[model samples]
Target: MSHPIIRVAIADDHPVIRMGIEAAIDEIPTLSCIGAVGDSSALVALLEQSACDVVVTDYAMPGGAFGDGLQLLDHLRTHFPDLRLIVMTGLDQPAMIQALHASGIDHILSKADDTSHVPAAIAAAWANRRYLSPSITQLLPARGAPRAIAALSPREHEVLVLFVSGLSVNEIATRLDRRKQTISTQKTAGMAKLGIDKDADLFKFASELGLRTARPDTE
Candidate 1:
């Protein structure tokens, strides 16, 4: 008996990236590229019209009726709770990674890293397992002094992580679905608990705590 083919969709703003992912999917006998879209709106439209086993998408695609980044992810999670999503992006900051995980994305791939693992990521997602790029795994906070991250409440920790990841107060507020003032208060409280008084100090503290550098290496 033949196993069912896994119908996959690719969503990214760049045509080249979409094509590359499609080609990768084509190489796998059990997987088929059912849709390739440039934005979240198109992705949603395609999903409404067909069944897809997995969706591989960019994290920061702009110019769509449904928005992008965390918003797009949130929309998909809310509307299509059963769809498996694999986010492939250059945004590998720890806070963003944490947020994506919290948002129910089980697979993440780094655009700056090699694409050889794309097939593996898809396979893992198809099997309902989590897959994080090695580059992303390295960015997670190392096991160390428990008090470093334990001092803050869950919301506070989230705020601090996003802040340290370089998201502005308003942007984080928008992403977390909280008011600007609430996010500001959480930032202040979290920083106070961590004894971080300045932006530079916060970055330094986060670095020491094992958050990866956000800068991509230049070739």
Candidate 2:
């Protein structure tokens, strides 16, 4: 007799996407967007402070002093184990999706995905079901994900991911805040460790690393 009550949170540095999500949730019958954050630190605070059943967040947040979506995912998984997650990113790769899959991300949506699919993705995550944007399903290359992931050292792994995301050695340097040469060496070492040969291979490797699946482990 009563519709389900789903309190939701959204995080993204982008205005259009955040506005779109807020608008959509406002129109939905049983859902509410309670907290919307522009930066990762704000997101963490919102999570700790708000009451919500699911949190939908952008995969990459620019101007986010803490832009690593994976890190937020990990923190949520660690501190709010019962909270559900929907991960949306413009970067859809086999490795990234697979990593999110392993980390128990309930839904994976692409920004280019149909807007109608957003509500459905939220519903699936609320139900503890999984959904992925069709484009993500089709385009994510699964071939190298597992092998490449197994080969990465933790730091090299982090460097490899930032590198492949088109972050320059300097940007990566700035994000990681290391010296330019240090970032260069890390890139070189990560490349050697992963045997990344070309841009194509670089993408394949990023996919498996599950940069989206950065959930913290309790055990």
lDDT of each: 0.77, 0.71
Writing each residue's lDDT as its tens digit, candidate 2 over 9-42 gives: 9888888889888888887889988878887888
Error of 1 at 141 (Å): 3.3
Residue 135 lDDT in candidate 2: 74
Model 1 lDDT per residue over 10-81, tens place: 999999988888888788898888889999889999999999888899987998998876778889889988
Best by lDDT: 1
Worst 10 residues of 2 by lDDT: 210-219
